[model samples]
Target chain A: MEFSSKLLENAVNEISQLPGIGKRTALRLALHLLRQPKENTHGLSKALNQMVDDLKLCKSCHNISDTELCDICANPMRKTDVICVVEDIRDVMAIENTASHKGLYHVLGGKISPMDGVGPHDLNISSLVEKVKSGSVKELIFALSPTMEGDTTNFYIYKQIKEFEVETSTIARGISVGDELEYADEITLGRSILNRIPFENSLKL
Target chain B: MEFSSKLLENAVNEISQLPGIGKRTALRLALHLLRQPKENTHGLSKALNQMVDDLKLCKSCHNISDTELCDICANPMRKTDVICVVEDIRDVMAIENTASHKGLYHVLGGKISPMDGVGPHDLNISSLVEKVKSGSVKELIFALSPTMEGDTTNFYIYKQIKEFEVETSTIARGISVGDELEYADEITLGRSILNRIPFENSLKL
Candidate 1:
């Protein structure tokens, strides 16, 4: 769209560069900012610049942090011996929200996707190996999504540290807790049956 | 959702304050920024802050501009005697895209909405009336949206300018150019029939 002001065009150009935002949406948002009090725009820009300039990545877990270590990795109460390996920090946040996993997280940053030109070296796998080789971690859980790339990454990491004395496992895969059996995909349904636990085990949760 | 970094949380909070953006979407956008190169985040923040800091409203039409008069108002090619009154600069852009009207514009900034505590004083209506009283304007087109507030605004301005010798008219209200008759709203279809021009006149376009 044609912008009367050069500054407006510049702002819209930058905003639309973001994922999922289009030129039309960027224009609407920029116009909305123009209509509001000056402080709102000032606050938005200041916060964004500050976050990018001062934000830190956890040295241990590879998760976002304000300090050298993320809160999860810094918390002594969490099970440091068990590290849940995942694709990105979003997964870390999702797992954290559930409060189900008390173990530490090792964000892989991204999975090994050859199609996307992302390989094992592109991930945080080496540091994970170092963490495992140090012998502090007793167990390493593969919490990556059940995709081809995820599975490949998991296998690659397992091969790297298989000689170590750490126990390795993947998160369980099956139908959702409240989903109908008929709606379950054939692969998932078959897996659920093959990996069936004792009837008593289902009642534990 | 819990954030590992206070800076991340602050950025999300500020970004979410924009119209239609929620907390989850805000976090997604902020994270997207973080994942990109540092230059991307710097560019976004710099553009946003610069636009808000240096932006100007045209003194004549109140369309956003960098100088005293907007490009259109300052242009000699456009007719200054005929003014198209609109609710905002977005309308100006819409009408400009049509390339149908070559006259200047008078932006009202916003409609008079009592439900939103917006009155005539909140708009640029007085300056518009003053423009008419100056006797330089030959005609004024009411190009506001076809809503209750739009109608109220048009009528209010009409009462203010009736004493002047300026010709006043509302933009045509009818079915859109490509709209099917069956799907056309009752009011629009009825108005299209009532305001039907002569067959030969329609051929002029």
Candidate 2:
């Protein structure tokens, strides 16, 4: 349907491109934005522009950052020897919220989803293997999702690091399935982290 | 939860302020924006900034426009003599989508809702009465919702214009009830407009 203006229609189209937002919801969002004060709109626009201009993927961890290395990767206080591997930056946030995992993180960007054309090459799996090869890390924790793609990625990473003396483990997955690690409640994810199992043990079971 | 970066969190917060968006939805939207090309983000940001910078309320009709008068009010093909009075610019768009109405529109901003502290003065009622008094307009069509506040506003405007030579009427209420006009499909709204009744005759009946 035609809207109040072309600009409004454009805004709605942009908003509807977001996951879970339909045309009617997009229109509602557009109208809400239109009713907001000028400063609110300006703040939103400025924030978006700043994200585009200033934000970058951290070279070390692949997490979003303002500088070359993300805060988690650059922090001297965090344990660099214990590396937690996740599918995305959101998982980093999820693990960080518990304040229990003091280890560093490696964001693989995504899992091995051949159906979606995402392969191991598309992820940061090589960097993760290189990190293990450095011999400094004592433990490699797999914090990937419990889904099939997550399992595939975890198995691939484990196989690459099997020769290393570093301990390789996957976070417990009984609590979450068929969902992103970001959506898992903090408590559940924290418990899962605490109850991790060795990759070989999981395969044996 | 601690996120990848402060800027990403800020963007998520701003997006969540839009109608019907929650934390998860906002995060999904933020992730989508992050994945978009630099040009797409720039275009979205520019559109938002331009919406705040360029749009203003039409002084005569109160419809949103980049200029003092909206396109409909400025168009020579539209019948200036028959003004379709609506609660807001959204209603004008709803009517415009029908492609049946050939008249100009007058937007009242909102209906009179005393419980919500919205009074007659809060609306553009005075400008509407003045337009009718100017004697240039031949008809004033009230395309308000079928709610208590809508009925109240319509009656108030009708009473103000009854003394003038202008023909006063209201769009049919067969398809809607109270604030539900925003949800009404286009065909229903169009049919309602076509079946409008004379204000004086409806009062007598």
Best by DockQ: 1
lDDT of each: 0.93, 0.83
Q: Model 1: which residue pairs collide? A: none
The CA lDDT at A198 in model 2 is 85
Clash count list over all predictions: 0, 0
Candidate that would win on TM-score: 1
lDDT of 2 by residue, A9-120 (tens): 6777776666777887777766677777878888888888788778889998899987889988899999999999998877888889878789899989889999999988
> Which pairs clash (backbone N, Cα, C closer than 3 Å) in model 2?
none
Q: Name the regions of candidate 1 deviating beyond 4 angstroms.
A: none
For each candidate in turn, the TM-score is 0.96, 0.80
i-RMSD per candidate, Å: 1.0, 1.9
Residues B32-74, candidate 1: write the lDDT tens digits.
Answer: 9988888998899889888888999999999999888889988
